[model samples]
Target: MKKVSFLLSASALSAIAVPALAQDVVFKPVVEARLRYETVDQAGPAPLTSSRDANAVTMRLRAGGEISKGPFAFLAEGEGTLAIDEDYNSGVNGKTLYPIVADPENVELNRLQLQYRTKPLIVTVGRQRINLDDQRFVGSVAWRQNEQTFDAVRVEYMGVKNLKVDVTYAISARTIWGIDGGKFGSANRPTQIDGDDVFANVSYKTKLGTLTGFAYLVDEDEAVVALRRNSSQTYGARFVGALPFTKKVKLSYLASYARQSDYATNPVHYSADYVAAELGLDVAAFKLTGGYELLGSDAGATGIAGGFAFQTPFATLHKFNGWADKFLATPGTGIQDYYAGIGYTVPKIGKAGPLVASFTFHHFSSDRLSIHYGDEYNAQVTMKLNKHLSALIKYADYERKGIASFTGDADTKKFWAQIDYAL
Candidate 1:
């Protein structure tokens, strides 16, 4: 309660400060609402079978204004959540015996920042979102009901055309999902880490294609420090452009390699490497994509390991191969995944928005060639009701091909319907 009070007070005071300079300040209020229904058929291992069928509602209200007179600007946003249907936990094998105190009604601040923008340079400090090139490993985790936001200081320079640079330093992480929520971990010992990460990227365009190079550095704290020892770094490049074959067809590709050393948060001192590549083609109303990834692992290594696969903490994360979430932590043996998919947009109906649909198939294997593999199928559909409203539904299934791990081979199914409105 005290923390929330402090934040609200701070926001009010910050807003008042802008008018002192006699600059005409403009305040814009922002608001958004979302309602979701989800059903989980199975979760976790036996003796603790878990599943949930519940309805969740989230709301966000924000008031921010600009100090039009100067190069300074400020913004603040807050959000809260609510859950309906108290008996929903029964779907998880009678695990809802206790009173539900953690149901989404908790209110929290999402973003509060002050910025200074000038020709060629821009600086921002406060709670915000940090997303860089594809958001593979480092991202804001925005798929959940509440989006994960970072508290940091960032700067950018764009003095030259076709060339841009950015840097960010974080002091804390205000995760959208509750610390004790299953989305993160057990309530008994919720994990929270404080640290800093830096990222830089440079891009150039030519007649044939555009090339981009990026690097990242992440330093961990004590609690999360074990996840990445002193620090971790990544370097990679990407090229995307249209094909010379024809004017109606387009092609794109991405390739990256990362090396991990003792800087990893684990106690074990080991090094790993990752390689990933993807190819995509666009023609008419349909799009096709395929990709391959290989994560390196030493057979003798112990502890949670790293992989080269593209890690998206958001974007319907469960759609990826392997178990929906069983491999979120990644195994030391490493992994290899081959995937392909197609996407198309259906023609719009009279007075209705267009329908978007996609299907993807993925095959997963161990980089060490030890265990058998598995595969998954994912499909989803989405439609927009209007400029500010949209709806979505998705499904995913994973099947074991050979050997299986504790993650389970038993088929799992999930269904979700959601409506979002923004202003």
Candidate 2:
């Protein structure tokens, strides 16, 4: 025979090329880089250029890859941002007298997915990146610089045992101002928003910790008209925990609640509520915190200044109420925050890696309107300049009292410096 039929056809093509080279060795590659410097000093009223101060220099780049087999997996990502010294107003670059540095510039295609897993269940599809939990009403705003994504279809279920269940539906919603950001009634960056949105979450884990429940339904069409009056529907619950108070101490807590109304082609009918609570303590590395939050108010049907409130508009609102961001919307006479903090870590130098410092304070008011929208002070320092680098320096200050029937405005400050690298 012809050399024993060529060694049985080369062992059947090496058993199909060794399982496709072991599925390309489970490909994986994702990179990240960020560099930023921001500054803003506000006191309000600068109709396009009287100078309220603003200085921004940004850079962000993300690239991606992911692959798998045996349950399927795939991912793709791309993001970019560049604005070297834009001197403010990046709300799609109108440069309105400086101030709002919403990080514009552009590049897109951030995340393309496909997944499937098992053990309980899991599934994902299309453009992704949905951050629930602590995102405080869904997120991915990722502190601007072009983030926020969706275009979904997601699912998860953890077959009980500590539980977990997630769901998503989405149709569009991909804003952070990239790719020339504009469309859908653009007044300043809209970059896609076609909605049908839906999200759900369920969590469980115990021993005094974890517990969640959520629901969100946001619907929009054509767009504009203030995002179709920001169509809404929400429901929530949260609980977080920690306890050990000894052996170096520990105690942490959080509680949350939510409620909202008006949905589908909303034309304003109103109903709102939201609340939060927090407490923390650590010891050993020192840490302390206190918090309270509320965002309720809604007096529709001719109640004057009460069309709506309790909005999140896809949160990550600069991590909440004031980073000098001065309430990223949610004040149709609603908002009440009171906060406190303290932190410290340091104690890892040599090869460089850990370091932290913090301070915070905030007090804002107005829920049903007694006004008093001000008082803030924050500071930070962070570092982890090692395995892939990290660094940050931040500050924020806000002071504006508002009393005579809400006069709030003027007095604000912000600053930041950051660097990051990852792979």
Candidate 3:
């Protein structure tokens, strides 16, 4: 019977090729790398250094991948770095070293992106990382080992379930390490052309928490409005809950007011006002935070000045406050900031992992409408020897009182130890 009709058509083509190879469409790839070491010590006045020392080493790499079929999906990533030994115009007795580690085997290109999701819509476009709200002034600086990436196009919406919405627009920005790394210079480079930033947020959630409202706009191009006219327009509101006398201890509050006119093209057309507040505590693994900020002055504005403010895209932004960064440009007698911090997470020494710590203190003054004021201290420690290795250490110190000659009472110290691995 013709060999049983060719074995029943080869068993119906092997059951339709085993469900089309189980509905094939799978892709996965990823990579990561890191190495770091640092040291610095400096001291005040004559002979340029109550003391001095420096040593550095750094390396990084990353790779990406992802793809799916059912609801459709895709993703991408990239990274690079190198900064071994370090020697960019070395100085010991002449004092000419402030992160000018020129040729530590330089390499760039931090991130590349592409994403899509459906179910309330989610979209992302090339060169990513942007953080709004509570970032305190824009973000994505990523603590530098080469970060800060944006070439944007982002959109997000959550149908309804406590209401959520997000929007982002940016054409270019790729600044990470090198603008004179560390203390950033080249006039604080970060204004890649075709600039645009617009953020709109609306949120509502209850059970005694979550409320947000925001509007922020940034438009620049003319060399970033001739070096930070900061292209103004801002409005804000934020509130977080769970402290009706303690629901495990949690509280948050923020208020913002901005009115900067003359379009700020930098020929000194002044108008300014800003205010801030924050408080938080968690109590289980222990955490505490505090904040107070104010900037207001414009009576004969010659070029509007302010204080303790200049996040300018963040990522471990020097833990915020003055050392010799010369107040990061903002002084028209406008500035004041008081800060506090504490954090701890231990609970896991038996498995050889778990230990974290933090400490911060800052007090800067100046708003007799903006010159400069100073006091700062910061510390951090981290340890986790499992799930891909980890270790870190950090420190910073600064002090200067009474407009201390452009604020450089010149007492600084920095040190870091690092180890990280993941795949």
TM-score for each predicted model, relative to the true structure: 0.81, 0.32, 0.31
Question: Please, what is the whole-model Cα lDDT of each candidate in the order they appear?
Answer: 0.59, 0.79, 0.57
Answer with 2 or 3, whichever has the higher TM-score: 2
TM-score, structure 2 vs. true: 0.32
Q: What digit string (tens of lDDT, one per residue) describes model 1 on residues 1-423? A: 343344445545765676687756766666777777655554334533444433333333333334434776777777666555444432112235321112343456677877778988888777676776666655665555555676677888888886777777765555544433333233221223455556667777777677777766655544543344435566667666656456657787777776655444535555667777888887866789999877666555445443222222222333234324445534556677788999997767565577788888878777775654567777889988878888889776666565454344434555567787776
Q: Which sequence of candidate numbers ranks them by lDDT, best first?
A: 2, 1, 3
Query: Which of 1 and 3 is ahead in TM-score?
Result: 1
> Residue by residue across 1-423, what tens digits does model 2's lDDT show?
232233223333433443474645477899998999999887744332236588899999999877766766667789989888888878766666677778887888887766778889988777778989888777898877789987777899999899999999877777787766663334535777776879898999999999988889998664456677667899988999999969888999999888988889877778888999999998989999999999898866233455468777777788987787768777688889999999998779788858999998988888874778778999999989888988999999988774322323567788999898998
Q: Identify the runs in model 1 with alpha carbons over 4 angstroms from their true place.
A: 1-16, 43-70, 86-105, 179-192, 224-231, 244-247, 264-266, 302-323, 406-410
Lowest summed lDDT over 10 consecutive residues: which window, candidate 3?
A: 87-96
Candidate 2, clashing residue pairs? Answer: 48-97
RMSD of each: 4.9, 24.1, 24.3
TM-score attained by model 3: 0.31
